[model samples]
Target: MSRSTLRRALRAGALCLTATTAAAVIPAAADAKVGVSTKRLNIQTGSRVTVKGHVDAPGVAKLQVQRRGRWVTLDRDRTNRSGRFVLRKRIRGAMSSRARLRLSTGETRLLGRMNVYRSALASWYGPGLFGNKLGCGGTLQAGSVGVANKSLPCGTKVTFRHNGRVLRVPVIDRGPYVGGREYDLTAATAHKLGFSGHGPIQVTK
Candidate 1:
């Protein structure tokens, strides 16, 4: 081949190599400044909670939650055209929760805390229906704190503390068999609280 043609080919090859190297380096330099931001976190037991926030990076690859010493991946999403990310997750039990964001360049982390409490409203069921289906999909027991409510969704378990005693009961039927009261405690629950013959006791739902 002619020397001019050979020299021209060499120049084109060098230009291509330099362009590829610059392309790779530019993204890495941009990623060094990317990071995540946490906005809000509120967690509860037997309920759903939302986590919201944003990410600042040239490009984000993954988002997740770290709880109980484990990691749960949040859905992969992009920041707005303005470069921000928002995400959420549901907490189920008592544990430490944290947020993690992965960017093409690096990673960002945030921390949060939560507490789980027993259901606030627990009552009792009556006799004769001891073997019947409790609203919570379980068999009813007289001594158990099984409540009957027309409004509360069936299968919901209510929890309450009485005179230093704590009780967790499933909701079942619906009424205060005799009086126009809100709940009807079984003979057993009444006996446990020293109020077998008394009326509705104060309950927390």
Candidate 2:
């Protein structure tokens, strides 16, 4: 063969080999991506839930949880080089939930659900605290049914049934510290519920 023709053929063969190698490497890289998994399928409301799972990647990534169309971002970390990711978050409402992880180059999605129940006890706060800054970044009103929780977020709204009456209260302040009470009722709330004294009630979110 002429020298020019031989050189041209060699160049074509090299190009073909490079293309073949790339085709094989692409799928293998994708297959090496990480993923997440969970042991529990259902979670309960008014209670803390832990999401346990692992990923399947070479390094760490960011994890997240989605519930009722709301997204909660998880912390960033590395996977066990085996590409496993395990994480957890609290169940704040009575709705279905899902999770996803953003790794170095890809993402993994998982599905889950939460089951909420009525509160066994309920309460509220206001009055002498009117115009006071609430944990929810709003002014407190004596006429409004708002409670305070030490741990629950500031703007959480909980509904409960008492004396055949149903009421929903926004969480505002902090605590009762009186007894092992699950909730502390404001004076106005107590009167509205027709309960002169703190009593048992049912609550839900």
Candidate 3:
């Protein structure tokens, strides 16, 4: 081959190698998820929590909470070498916001639900009432799980939390009929949540 032809072939080979190296070094999507410190929260103003998670690509990411029906950005942080980042925020009031991590690639990954609840007074029932008909139709058995509310329609579902335990049950009956109480928990519902006697418990819609 001629000298000039040989030089041209060498230049083409160098260009192909550079292109391949550049393609191999291109960055990938973070493909990460957002996580919260807690799954359930009883807000008391000034309550704070840590939001954290990792990504495949280590970089800055936006931490956000769903508020007023829209995603609002709360803060931002750069991930460590492991692509992990942690951010802390004080909760202002009751919220049903879900947490998510927004990476620089514009991809958002859902972490978990941070359900906030309101406090309400509750009482348990079931002693001699097992054979009676439930307001929602079925017979109230000893193991039947549900709650009774004055205004909530029969069969309405209610979520209750007590002593770090959570329970979800439907309104299978009517109520305590007495004033100053919001819910009357069936014996089984109360037991599942570790709730006993009469007191305040966390409730969510």
Candidate 4:
């Protein structure tokens, strides 16, 4: 073979080797960035849940929840030596709220919905009951959010959805002892659902 031809082949081989090395390095660089996720994509209200994930380096992660379209801090903690963190807490308040694990690196991992329910005959009560003490606790008010059922244990979480709106409220009271009605929602819940006096709504166990 000619010397010039041999030299040309050597140059092409060197270029191919350099290209392969660059491609390999790209992924390694990307992996060095922070990433996070929750152990369970969906969680039930009032249940202890954990958000576990890795940071680019050992550091803190801020757990936040979305309420009224704003992100509010739920908790904060640091990662372990392995650059991984697990934040465990009993989640309460609005169950339909969105949540996420956010790192200082500006990376975030969203947690999915916890409760998904079935359809039921739902009715709302409030006007005349306002200022009255609830059967379970707290007073019945226009802004109260909850459901009343005949058999379900008090404080049991029930998911409801109507007219594109969703709510996961506890069984704070009993009844709708009136037949054909499976659940009774408070004024607030009904309003959020765009429900009138009565109608069919979704319910989750």
lDDT of each: 0.55, 0.60, 0.76, 0.74
Candidate 4 lDDT over residue span 9-83, tens digit each: 999999999999989878543433555565653444566666677786666887777777899876688888888
Q: Encode model 1's per-residue lDDT on 1-205: one tens digit a residue.
A: 9999999999999999999998987853333444444444333455444444554444654555765578667556566766765555555553334555555555655444332333333344466777876544666665565667666776665553456554556566665445455565555655666555444454544
Q: lDDT by residue for model 3 over 21-98, one digit each (tens)? A: 999999964455544443323344456656666666767877677876898877788889877777666766555557
Each prediction's total of clashing residue pairs, residues at least 3 apart in sequence or on different chains, is 9, 17, 0, 2
Local lDDT at 85 for model 2:
58
Model 3 is weakest, by summed lDDT over 10 consecutive residues, at 36-45
* TM-scores, all models, native as reference: 0.36, 0.39, 0.64, 0.48
Top candidate (TM-score): 3
Q: Candidate 1, which segments miss by more than 4 Å at Cα?
A: 1-38, 46-49, 61-63, 67-69, 114-205
Q: How good is model 2 by TM-score? A: 0.39
Model 4 quality (TM-score)? 0.48
The runs of at least 3 residues in candidate 4 whose Cα sits more than 4 Å from the true structure, single-residue gaps closed, are 1-111
Question: How far does residue 108 in candidate 2 sit from its true spot (Å)?
Answer: 31
Go through the candidates in order and give the C-alpha RMSD of each one to the true structure: 11.0, 10.0, 5.4, 13.5
Q: What would the per-residue lDDT of candidate 2 be over residues 1-205, giving only the tens digit for each residue?
A: 9999999999999999999998987864444433334544344464554444555546656556665677666456666655565655555665433555556665555444333344455444555777777666766666656666667887777665567665567776778666667777666666677655565666555
Candidate 3 local Cα displacement, residue 166, angstroms: 1.8
Cα displacement (Å) at residue 118, model 1? 4.9
